[model samples]
Target: MKINSKKVTVQKSSQALCEYLSDVKNFEALMPDNISKFELIRDDAFVFALKGMPEIALEVKEVEAPHKVMLGALSDKIPFQLTANIETINANTSQVELVFEGDFNPMMAMMIKSPITKFLETLAGNLEQIQ
Candidate 1:
C-alpha cells in the first residue's frame, strides 16, 4: 500500500516558522492525544509513542526544520513513513504539505490513513494556536 497526503498553507514567515519547528521538543507539546510519550533522539530525530495503535515508535529520518521533516514508523506491524514538507510563499506566510507512503497489511493500511489525516489536521490547528 502507498500513503499519500497534502495540507493547507499557513500565513506565517518562513524564518519564523522554521524557528518554531526547529526544536523537536516543541512538536511533542503540539501533538494531540493520538501521540504520547514523545521524545527527541537527536537534532530533528525522535522516537514517540502512538496511541490507539500498537504503541508504535516514530523516528525522524530527515528534516529541514520548518521546511520539511521525514518520519518513519519503527513498529513491526506497520511499515509506513511520512514526509511533511512546509513552504514559505511570502513574508509572514507559509504552508505545510505532506507525503506518506508505506507497505502494510490490508486492514492496518486502511486503519492508518484516516487517523493520520485527523492527526495532521489536529497538528495544524495546534500550530495555528501558537504565535
Candidate 2:
C-alpha cells in the first residue's frame, strides 16, 4: 500500500533539510516519545523499536541533493520503502512530504493502514517543530 503525508512548509532550506535527514542519528528527533530502542549501525543506518513493534533496521539508502531522500529497511519481515520529497520555496524555507509504501497482503494492509497514516502525519508535524 502507498501512503503520503500532507506537505508541510518549514523554515529550513532544502539543503539544510537534506543534510539533517541524511544523518540517521537525526531520525531519533523525529520519533515519538514511545521509541524504546535506537541503535546506530553506521553513520547512515540504525535499528529502532517502538512500543509494541519488533526491531527494524533502516538506512538512508539514497539521497539527491536539496531534493529527495530514500530510506529503506534491512529486515525482510516488514518490507517497506520511505521517501521524503522536498521542495524549495525560497532560500530560507521549503516544503517537505513523506511517501511510504509497504509490501503487505490484503489483511495486513488493512490492519496497518491507519497507524502508518498517523505515523506519517506525526513525522510531518515534527518537521515543523524541529530545529
Candidate 3:
C-alpha cells in the first residue's frame, strides 16, 4: 500500500472545526469544485461517482467527539485500505493525518497514491482557508 499524510491547522475554534469535520457534507463543500458529484451514503461512507479522484468509497470507521475521526477506503482498482484521521489540536486549531495500508499489486500503487495525496493536499489547502 502507498501511504501519505498531511497536517493542516485551521484558525478556528475546535468546536467549530469538529462541527464541520463531523458533517460529511462539509467535505463536499471543502473539496475542490472539480468534483462534479459526491455523496455520503447512509452506511456512513462517501461515494464519488467519477473515477481518478481517489478512493471510490470511503467508510467512516471511527469518530471521537471534538477530537478525531477516522475513515477507511479500499481503492476502486487496487486492494489497498486507505485510512484518513482528522485530529483537533485545540479549540482553535486541528490537524489531519492519513494512512493507507495494503499490499497492492504493481502499477496500481502509483495510480492510487497520486490522487489520494492530491486530495489530502487539497483538503489541507481548503482547511487553511477556513476560518
Off by over 4 Å in 1: 1-6, 64-66, 75-77
Per-model clash counts, in order, read 4, 0, 1
Each prediction's TM-score against the native? 0.72, 0.95, 0.71
Tens-place lDDT per residue, model 1, 36-126, is 6677767765666667554546666666766877777766566777766788788888877666778867787687778777766777777
The whole-model lDDT of each prediction reads 0.69, 0.90, 0.64
Clashing pairs in 3: 14-91
- TM accuracy, model 3: 0.71
Best by lDDT: 2
Best model number under TM-score: 2
Lowest summed lDDT across 10 adjacent residues in model 2 is found at 26-35
- Write model 2 residue lDDT over 4-113, tens digit each, in one string: 99999888999999998898898888887788999999988999888887788988889998899999988878899889999999998999999999899999999989
**After superposition on all CA atoms, how large is the RMSD of candidate 2?**
1.0
